[model samples]
Target: MKKTYLLLTALIVFSYTAIAQAVPAAAKMNQFIDQLMQKMTLDEKIGQLNLLTPGGGIPTGAVVSTDVEAKIKNGQVGGLFGVIGAEKVLQAQRLAVEKSRLHIPLIFGSDVIHGHKTTFPIPLGLACSWDTILIKQTARAAAEEATADGLSWAFSPMVDICRDPRWGRIAEGAGEDPFLGSAIAAAMVRGYQSNNLRQDNTVMACVKHFALYGAAEGGRDYNTVDMSRIRMYNDYLPPYKAAIDAGAGSVMSSFNVIDDIPATGNRWLLTDLLRNQWNFNGFVVSDYTSVNEMEAHGLGNLQQVSALALKAGLDMDMVGEGFLTTLKKSLQEGKITMRDINNACRRVLEAKYKLGLFENPYRNVSTERAATTILSPDKLALSRKAAAKACVLLKNDKTILPLQHTGTIALVGPLADSRRNMLGTWSVSGDWHHAVTLKEGMENVAGQQVKIVYAKGANISDDSLFNKKVNVFGPEIEMGPATSDVMIQEAVAAALQADVVVAALGEAADMSGESSSRADIGLPESPQRLLTALVHTG
Candidate 1:
């Protein structure tokens, strides 16, 4: 037994050393970045900061962009976010490495929020279950599906400790406790990266909305945030720091302004704290267009804000070519140093190297493997299990749930049949048609003894403004014209005859995330009205 254990230890040490040889020395990696930068023009370098999403994997806002190929070939784009599927990712990736002049490989990213192909429960609900292992497993499965879809990074494990339920984006985080949030943050990092990111089926994890997007004043996303450093360290910084400690390779800055400065321009937070204090060796990327939004935060023009961000240690600017457009000019003007540009570029290149992209650019974009692995039954089974576990039994009055598969069940609401919303927020590349809605779950799980009666009780969301904002990603929530009176009459009639009534309720697709804040987060009027009607009838 002792000889066997000694032999295993030797084998493991040899394996780690072999893997270590693949990485260029820190100094050599910097030299490689330097040589590459010397050969590249400013526009080409700047193009790397622009992350665009073309609709395919998971939807972001109301719509996905249509011209991804042109942008990649023209060198106008740096990376892609909403695209997935191995073949699609492969096609997009080939455009960057082969078609473009720089031949730089594009990093494919996605929300991969819960289970990638297997729709896990939303993050907030998952956190409520207080199971860290389950959460990590969720991230592991997400990495597997995402890599299978040819993505290299995930914008996930949004770790901001939000105490206010009024904050709709809170549904995307660990919720209300920094201690718990920090622990979950570390677990997710471990899950996404595993012990070796260079290996197959692992994707880089981006600890996001860095600092405190969740602390949006009045619970509004992108609203200003002000808190003392002591408070930040004691309460909020832990999760971001925990993610860093756990080896998350990248961090995305939030849209919210911290103190008096927009996060994108906060030199103290990004430089002194993130790099110096935490000693985080990875790159920092901005949230969607956050660099441009600095203008809204009262910061100056694009050039000035972009310079400030680079000096402050921001490495990548997502969807905003602020750095690419202004950095060289700033370098000439002495506002920023070549060292700063070198550092940022080095960070980005190191990320690519750590992902093993140089060795095999198509490592994750395997078409044959994707066919065999993308939506396998095992993955689907995991999704169904995760969905079942994430369902919070908020109110199971009289033990009304664990609902025996026995009687007529009224499965109602826009989400009941929602093919798209099932993936939920940030699951940009996830396939909605693949998700099993409550209606489908009923058909699959409800036994032969049960009869299912369904209705489109109401739309997912009824607010015009909310619809406009959310519809930017895909389908706007359209209200049901089955009038409140008629829907109520129908619902009441069905409930009266049925053995049980199952009412599903929640936010419309667009009620959370960037620019999706809602001051009144109560159930939308349609469902609220429908619930009221059902109660009055009873």
Candidate 2:
């Protein structure tokens, strides 16, 4: 009994020592942020809650903020995405630290979803390997490249658990199981941020579309999601909690309603659950214009919804001027307290502080460093290995996959040589020109001993309206000058000349990402007809 008492006393002492050792770093961060916030004006404090994007990269929303340079100089911006390259990032950072009144360093971010410049398989594909280590490595590689290009934050590891394949964004997450989703979420956070946010090669991971976005009614993007609290806790919320617990620096609120309230304005969710219950210390940012989107959700006008979001614990507004335009008015109107605004601003500043931005704002912004680091040979090799591991062989009929290099092979489809679709979805920073298509890969692997005949079997879809919708980001689906019938004939002619036919068919990249849910998730009519023609030719 005496020994037990001594052991327990020793354990308590050790725990106290560990806590004592850890508190100073955190206390220092708090102290620094407190001092910085004191120097900021009301407009500057409000500006720290606004996240905007310049029009250089893909705009997920309709509006990209104009006068971005002016905003940064005026201290009306917190962070910027859509801007790539180290030189460009350095220029933006200079505007904030050199020109802004408080000279708070700006945090640059991007959607480094799967892999950065060195693109890998989509998240869903990576999840299929069920190898968390490999998944983590992919994220680590992405962080390395992203940081080299001067990005400090990655909006990644979309952990939404989706059972419905019709939901286009399912490709962006681990598949239907919450257990797997939770595991992958933790791995991703660890990979991106690791044990240190101050590390030059690390990036702050943002676990996104928080709280049951995958449960949208009818599998529609940004649609209503109605579910009981028990169901949400059991099926949908575990992955988010896992990410937060794993040290994700930020969370992005989903554009869905919980308990009939938009998530951006749900205090019970962002605060009561994420903060008080889960003990998540990170900040929360809304999805693209999600704060303003709440107005469309019938909550209120832009000003009212922005106020509700701030009071509910949303730290930063993404590409929406709601918080930038209306938070001051709300504070003046007594709709929200000054403490609320300060809390959000402090959280944003804390992220920058943790990133060691105050010590050296130019930590990752070096063109010389970027030239050697982004898409390095080792990273490209890792991407190749990841892609191979992610390939799921649904079936092997007659052991045909291990094809002989001596045979004439027919590689026929719109996707056969399509580089644009190779990287899949949400790969904003990936250059499709750098992507290796199936034909190119086959020729390289099969060598000159094999004669490879290729044909564009069909346009991805013959439906003009469907093509138009998928082509929003660019021409993912290009209706060729040749008719569908002519395309099928060409594919059949190629197939007849080959010993074996390899038909590559699937949805366009845009057909399976944000705002792209499909009611009938199947092969498009054009691909279906081409497949039929090829089979009938036998």
Candidate 3:
């Protein structure tokens, strides 16, 4: 017993020694950033706070930054998203380090939400599994693929806790349990960033839509979110705090109004709650044009709102150009202090330093690595395994699910043969061509012994306006030439011939992400009509 006690004391001492050893490394990093900041001019420092996206990937907002190349060369840009491919990233980094005056490196970022190239199930779907280890692995795989493509930052781990099914963005987050949501949030952060941001394969994780974004009024996108502080701390704020505690490298301010002030410009929320109360050391960035959108929220004009956001602890402005265009003038007018600008600039530069961009700007850029690493066999296999686990089995009447191998099966739905919606939403980098459809998967598993018939039971929706909205990124909902009645009859005909019928129906990929909120959370008219017909035929 004495010997055992001595050994336990030794272990505790060793742990303290290891922690003490890490303090010098932290001090050294601070010194380096301090030296770098001393050399930066006001304009150059403000440049570090602007994050832009070149026009290639999907733009979540109305404006994509113009003259991106010229801005990078002129030391007017800090980081960029939507710049895909290792080759392009190398070129962009070269422009920043070689052509710019300060020779500062640019950080590359992307919305690598679920999976990068090897697409996994959406976050909400993955949450159904309640397997935190599998969720972490998915995030790690996403980071590996993203970094191989020259991205150092991933704007993901959308940990907003939502109870409203009508909100389209609910699909982007874990469901409405704070304890489970907090666990998933920490797992994601650990997966993406791991224990080291300097590692080439790990990308920095950004916990997004901070505070109470998911509790938007009426389940609408970017709507007002007003909740009591008690409710916020008890029900809604746990996941965001959990992600921060897990060492998420950054946070994105939501577009909602919390307590009658825009989150981007709310000093109480961003400064007091995030930094003071919670001790979150990472920087804060605004959601897409959220700083500028505060003008529309009746806060102020572009300049006023930009100054307000800067003073409120928002370190970076994403795609708004509010910081780039108006910050210098705001500084001149004494509307915002140089210390505010300097503090924000230091945070942004500190993130770049942590990413090791200053030491090696091209650390993550390699065409060969990207080719070998993305969508590899192991990743695809993991994706398949995750998909299987994510599927929830609520009921199996008469043991219908374990379908006989030699029976005739009728698979009828718009989604059965649709590969476009397979990966779900926010998979900006996923290739739908590689996605296996439901019919193909069933055939592969059932083999030649089973006979299967498929039909596009109906269009996802008969509403033209809704379809148009869902198809913003691409053709998610394709309207076929056949009428609704004709399609329903065709599905009924297929069901009549088969011994068992399987109907695959749900929201299209875009129907539950970003701007795709629904007023009525029910099946669309077309799919509902088809399901009724199938029931009648039985």
Considering only N, C-alpha and C atoms within 3 Å, which residue pairs clash in candidate 2? none
Candidate 2 lDDT by residue in tens digits, 339-364? 99999998998899889999999999
Per-candidate TM-scores read 0.88, 0.96, 0.98
Which of the numbered candidates is closest to the native, going by highest TM-score?
A: 3
lDDT scores of the candidates, listed in order: 0.78, 0.91, 0.92
Model 1, position 302: C-alpha lDDT score: 94
User: Candidate 1 or 2, higher lDDT?
Assistant: 2
TM-score of 3: 0.98
- Tens-place lDDT per residue, model 1, 1-538, is 9999999999999999977874546666667667877887666666666677775434434345456688788776767887777888888889988998878888888877776766777787788767888789888888887898898999887898886667877878888898889988999999999998888889999998888878878887667788887888888888999999999999988878777887878888888888899998888998877787787766789998898888777888876667756887888999988778777776887788778876678889877777777677877776667666776766767887678867787776667777677777655556677766778877988889998888777776656776877778677476655666676667677777777777777765556755566777778777888788767655
RMSD of each: 3.9, 2.1, 1.2
Q: For model 1, where is the 10-residue window of minimal lDDT?
A: 56-65
**What local lDDT does model 1 show for residue 412?**
66
Compared to the true structure, candidate 2 yields what TM-score? 0.96
lDDT of 1 at 452: 85
